[model samples]
Target: MVRYSVLASGSTGNAILIQTDTTSILVDAGLSGKQIEKAMHEIGVSADCLDGIVITHEHQDHVKGAGILSRRYKIPVFCNQKTWDGMEHIVGEIKTGYQEIFCTGDRMEIGNLALESFAISHDAKDPVGYCVFAGNTKISVATDMGYVNAKMKQRIIDSDALIIEANHDVEMLRIGPYPWHLKQRILSDHGHLSNETAAEILTEVITANTQCVHLAHLSAENNMPVLAHMTVKTILEQEQFKVGQEFDLEITYPDKPTKLRSVRRR
Candidate 1:
């Protein structure tokens, strides 16, 4: 059994908590140390209960509070070499005693959890997503990526639970107030995922083993929870996949945290 919680998910910040019987890993720490502590307590997890913090990229929303939390709790911080370079300033500015860096694609064991990293298409230097296994169940998270490549799709296909990005709606983005260049940047290969793209990916890749699908990293100005959910739900139905009754679909907010989701593999 494994438990997963979305502390926060969006451009403002992002963090995920994955725990098994013997391991507790924090996927990212975008929130401040105090906010992270509060969210952890809401999910019935204490700071001391965490084994390590694995960062996805060097983006401010993902790395802002990581070093602070690591120094405060003395928890190990794992990230790729390039990410370390990008974050050296922010993380190094703070005095941290606990830090262990690893290259992308390396697998590491933290207590009972086995974590593997896969490259992702994002604007940041050396951005990657993660797949974690505990016993027979798998929990995968891939957000802040532009599009789902073949490799990303394959890695997430067999997971029991998936946290994927649905960043914006095409129409909203085109008409929104963001500058033309910024909009173009967001639509590029190394940008964020659109709602339609996310729907297509989920409809094509989700299987029976997938118990839940969380729509993450939504753009507040360009997307609404109702829109993202409806887009994916409609696509899944068109593909002859049952919605709600067969599997659960959740939407995470930038300001609000998601309920702690538990997975049981029989």
Candidate 2:
């Protein structure tokens, strides 16, 4: 069985743990090493048990603890060449042989898990999302994307579960306290995805075999969990899809673990 958990997600920090019977991997280590260790322990996994750390980009919320984790545990860190260049200094010193670079669209095996990285439209250099396969199950992690394009749709189509960004409500963001430039950036084509946009994308990608959706990367100031959940649910309902009956919807927390799930292929 393939099990995963969103250890933390949002502007402050982000991390995800994916595991099978024999292998465990961390998708990102945004939090401090101590925080990541405690979170892993809460889920009954040891920090030392992690096999590798795969990074999405150089953004602080995504790479803050990656180098430390890898160095401390003597585990490999995987990313594209561009990401390594952008994040190397911030992640501090990683020993030789601990850096593994894989290009976007390339599928690589780490233990029993097969992972594919695809480009995402974001401000960070070489930002991407991941599709992980274990046995018959597939889980897609697509956050920090400005908008969902056709290529992204195809990449995540029919996934057993998906963790996608629902960063903010457009109106809230527009009227919120953030300065004009920052607001404009977030609303731009290469910035974070709004809740409405994420809902629209879900309508196209979600299917009978898709079991769960986790709304991630919510902005504490511009989005509330209830608002994000209802917005997506409303869109699905308008599409004639029953919320709980058709699939489960959840929201990831910024400060703690949201949910632990085991996704099985249909």
Candidate 3:
């Protein structure tokens, strides 16, 4: 069985914990070190037990606590070369041996899990999402993306569970309090994914084998959890798919941790 939890998700911060019986991995550590430790403890895991940390990009909301976690726990941090270059100064000092680099499309092993990073359309330099394979189950983490392209769809297809972005609602963002430029940046091709777009992408990639969908990276100012859930649920239902029967849908919170979700081979 593979256990997954979104320790925190939103524009404010992002972190995900993926674990197997023998291995534990953290996808991003955007929250403070103390906050990350508390979230991990809530899920019955310790920060010291983490095997490694895989970073997606150089953005502050994703890399804020990465350095502290790496230094404190003596865990390896894996990221693309570009990401390493872009975030080295911001993340502060990481021990030489702990700073590891993996190519975007290549696979790397950490304990019992095989991790593959795939390119994502985001504003940061060489941003990517991760797909983790454990036994027969595959879990994909694909947040901080503007849109899902063919490659991204291929990467997410047949996943047992997914943690994908449902960042904002188009109408709400358009009429909200953010300045015009910020709104436009968020609506750009290299910006965050909207709730409707995420729903559309899920329709294309969701399969019978897929067991769970986690709507993540929500915007507090522009999106409500209920609205994001309803948007995706309504779309799936319109296509004659039963939500609870076909698969489970969950919304991750920005301020707290979500219950651990497990995917096991049938």
| lDDT of the candidates, in the order given | 0.87, 0.92, 0.92
The residue ranges of model 2 lying beyond 4 angstroms of the native Cα positions read none
Q: What are the clash counts of all predictions, listed in order?
A: 0, 0, 0
**Tens-digit lDDT track of model 1 for 19-123:** 987788899888788888888898788888888999999988898788888777778888998998998787664344466778888998889999999999999
User: How far in Å is the alpha carbon of 23 misplaced in model 2?
Assistant: 1.0
Candidate 1, RMSD to the unseen true structure: 1.4
TM-score of each: 0.96, 0.98, 0.98
What are the candidates' C-alpha RMSDs? 1.4, 0.8, 0.8
Residue-level lDDT tens digits of model 3 in 1-266: 99989999988889999999899999999998999999999989899989999999999889899999999999999999999899888789999899999888999999999999999999999999999999879999999988889989999988999999999999999999999999999999899999999999999888988999999999999999999999999998898878999799999998899998888755
Off by over 4 Å in 3: none
Query: For residue 85, what is the lDDT in candidate 3?
Result: 93
- Superposed by TM-score, candidate 3 places the C-alpha of residue 54 at a distance from the truth, in angstroms, of 0.1
Q: Report model 3's TM-score to 2 decimal places.
A: 0.98
- In Å, residue 226's CA in model 3 sits off its true spot by 0.5
